[model samples]
Target: MNIGFFNGEFIDINKAVIPIDERGHQFGDGVYEVVKTYHSVPLLLDEHLERFEKSATAIHIRLPYKKAELKSIIVEGIERAGLENAEVYFQVTRGIAPRNHLFPDVPPSFTLTVKPARKIAERNYESGVQTIIVEDDRWAKCHIKSLNLLPNILAKQNAVNSGNFEAIYEKDGFIAEGTSSNVFVVKNAVLYTTPLTSNILPGITREAILQIAKEEGIESKEERFTKDFLMNADEAFISSTSVEVLPIRTVDGQIIGSGNPGEMTKKLHQLFKGLC
Candidate 1:
C-alpha cells in the first residue's frame, strides 16, 4: 500500500487518519498543490512550493511547516513510496473542529500523498488528445488552488463521460481554462494563453512552458482569447502537473490543425521532454 504523510506521521494509506470534523471535510477550507517528478528527481519544486505558500496565504490558512521542512518531507515521502517518477499531492487544511461553518481556532493540518506518476499513453501524447468546451461557472477564487472543486469535478466528468480528455472552460465566449489544466493555443506562429487572473488557476507547467519558450526563442502572449479563436487556431494544448503539454487534436468534434498534432506542439513537447 502507498504510504501517506497524514497529520505528521508517514503511514500506510489505509491507516492514515483524518478527523471527520476537519474543516477540509466540512467546509473545504484548504489549498493543494501537485508537483511532478521524473526518474525520482522532483521537477520545478521551488516553483510549486512558491505557489503552495501563495495558496495557503490566499486562504488565510497557516502552513504547519516552513517551505524547507515541507520540501524535506516531500522528498522523504517520494523515497518511501519507491516511485522513480510520480506526482506528489500535498494539501493544507484548517484543522478539525465541531461541525460549523466558522473557522477553527486551531492550526491547519497538513497532508502529503505520493502516487505513481500518471503518464499519458504514447499514442495519446503522439496523436494528441481531445477536449470539449463547457461553460466556466467555477468560483471566483480559482487562482487560490483551494480544495473546493465540485464545479470542476462535474465539468471534467462531463467531458470524460463523452470520452474526451479534458473540459476547456469558457465564459461569455472567452476561454478561461480547462477544468483542471491551463488551456493554450497556437495561432499565427505565436502562443496565446489566459492572463493571470482570479478567473483562472495559476498552473506551474504553464510557467515552465513560458520559460521554455523564452529560452527557445518562441514567442508567447498572455492574452485572453475567445472560444472562436481557439476553434480557429492552428493548434491547441493543455498543461497540468499530470498532463504536460498535452496536444488537443479536436475540440467538440471539430478537428484542430489538420486533425493532428501541430508542428509547434511536437517541438514544444520535445523541448519539455528534454527539460525532464
Candidate 2:
C-alpha cells in the first residue's frame, strides 16, 4: 500500500487535496528529498534531511517541522506504506496564495508520499547502461534539490527517446553530472568525480561510495574530467539515492572501455548494497 501526507494530515493517495493556488504546483516553488528503504528501514535519512534543510534555506523557504518531527513523519509514512523497500518523497512549498509573483504570507505546505521502490532490471546491472552527453542548460544553482526540474525532465526524456538510460551534462567542456545522478569515472584504478560545487547536487549515495572507497583502500579523487577523459576511462557509473550505482556502457553512442561493466564497478556496487 502507498501513503500520502499533506499539511498536518495523512489522506488517501488519490485524494484531491491540493488547492489550485498551491505554489509547488503552480510555480515549482519547493525543495524535496527522496529516501530509499531496505528491510523496512529508511537509509541515511538524517543526511537527506540535512540536505533538505539546506535546499529549503537556499530557496528561502523555512520548513514547518523540526528535524525530529520530520523523521517521525517519514518513519510513520513507511509503516503505513507497508513495504520493505520504499521511496519516500517529501517537499516544502511556499504555500497557497493568490496569483502573484511575490512571496505569500501563508504558512509553508509540506507534502509527502511513500511508495514501493522502483527496481532496475538485473540485465541492466549486468550489461551496463547507455548514456548521452548533453550541454548543461540548467540554472547555476543545481546544488539545491529544488522542484524546478524542467531542464532535467527534458534531458532525461531526450535520453530515453534516443534509446539511452541516462543523460550526462557537460558544463564548459567538463563533465558536471547526470540529469538526475552524479557522474563518476574509474581510470587506472582511481575513482574520480566532480567536487562539491554550486553546479551539482552532493548526492548522499555518492558520499557513501567515496567513504566506502576510503574504507576499502581504494584510491579516489574529487576532480573534474572532460568527456574525452570519461570516454577513455576504464570504467564509469552514475550515483543517486534511487539508482544507487549504475554502470555506464556508452557516451554519445561510443562504447566505454570494453563495452561492459568493469570489475571495480561491480565490486563497488556490491559493497554499496552491503550498507543497505
Candidate 3:
C-alpha cells in the first residue's frame, strides 16, 4: 500500500511520473528529507519540515507548496499507505527543463513517497556495527540536504563491499561524520561529536541525542575529534533518522571500547525511542 505523489496528485508508487527532462532526474537539482513514523505519527516532523525548507532555499529552489500544504500531503500520503511505521521521503526539484546548465524559468517540482521503513538488524544494535574510515570527498555545502550524493554512495558501497556497516568520513585528520549519519564518541563518560559546519549534515537524531544528554546531565561536546581519538574512545556510535543511535564497535578493524554496545549508547537509544 505504498503511495507516491508527484506534481499535484497521488499515484501508485511504481508509476513513472517524472519526465525525462526533469531537472532533478538530469542534474540532481533538488533537496530531500526523510521522515520516519511510529504508531502512524511522524517523529520530529516540524523540525524535518524546517530543515527541508532551509535546504530548498539554500539550493535556490522554490518549493511548490507551503509548509501547511506540505504537511497535509505527508499526512494524507501516510494514511494512504496505511502503515504504522513508514519512511516518508519528499523532495523539491528545479523542474523540467531542456538540456542546459543554467536555471530554467519553470516552477519547481515536488515529489513524495511513503513506504514501510527499512529495519536495521537487531543483533547489530546488541553487538554494535563495524565501520571503515574514508576521506571526505564531497562538496563544501554538506549542510544543505541536496540531491548530489555520489561521493557518499561511493564510500558507503565501499564500506559494504568491505563488510562494514557504515563509512565514517575523515577530513583533515579529524572525523567529520559517517556517509549518511553523524559520528559521535564517548570518552571517559563525556560525549563528543563534530560541530555544526559546512562539512556535515545536521542530523535530527544527533540533535535529539545531544538534547537528551543535556536533560539527563550527561556531558556532551559538539567539537571535532581526531580519528585516533575515535579509535580509542570508551564508546562510539552513529546517528540518523533511520538508525536512531546505533553503536559503533570497530573502526578500521580495531575494536571500540569492549567491542559491545556501551551502556550510555543503549540508554541514549532507549530514550530516543521513547520520543517515537
TM-score for each of the candidates = 0.97, 0.99, 0.99
lDDT of each: 0.88, 0.95, 0.95
> Per-residue lDDT for 276 in model 1?
77
How large an RMSD does model 3 have? Answer: 0.6
The regions of model 2 sitting more than 4 angstroms off are: none
Model 3 TM-score (2 dp): 0.99
**lDDT at residue 98 of model 3 (Cα atoms):** 98
lDDT of 2 by residue, 152-244 (tens): 999999999999999999999999999999988999999999999999999999999999999999999999899999999999999999999
Clashes of 3: 0
Report the number of clashing residue pairs per model.
1, 0, 0
By lDDT, is 1 or 2 better? 2
**lDDT value, candidate 2, whole model:** 0.95
Identify the runs in model 3 with alpha carbons over 4 angstroms from their true place. Answer: none
Please give, for residues 120-167, the per-residue lDDT of candidate 1 as tens digits.
798887788889999888888889999999999999899999999899
lDDT for each residue of candidate 3 in 1-276, tens digit (9 for 90 to 100): 899999999998898888999998999999999999999999999999999999999988888999999999999999999999999999999999896999999999999999999999999999999999999999999999999999999999999999999999999998999999999999999999999999999998889999999999999999989999999999999999999999999999999999999999999999999999
**Window of ten residues with lowest summed lDDT in model 3:** 11-20
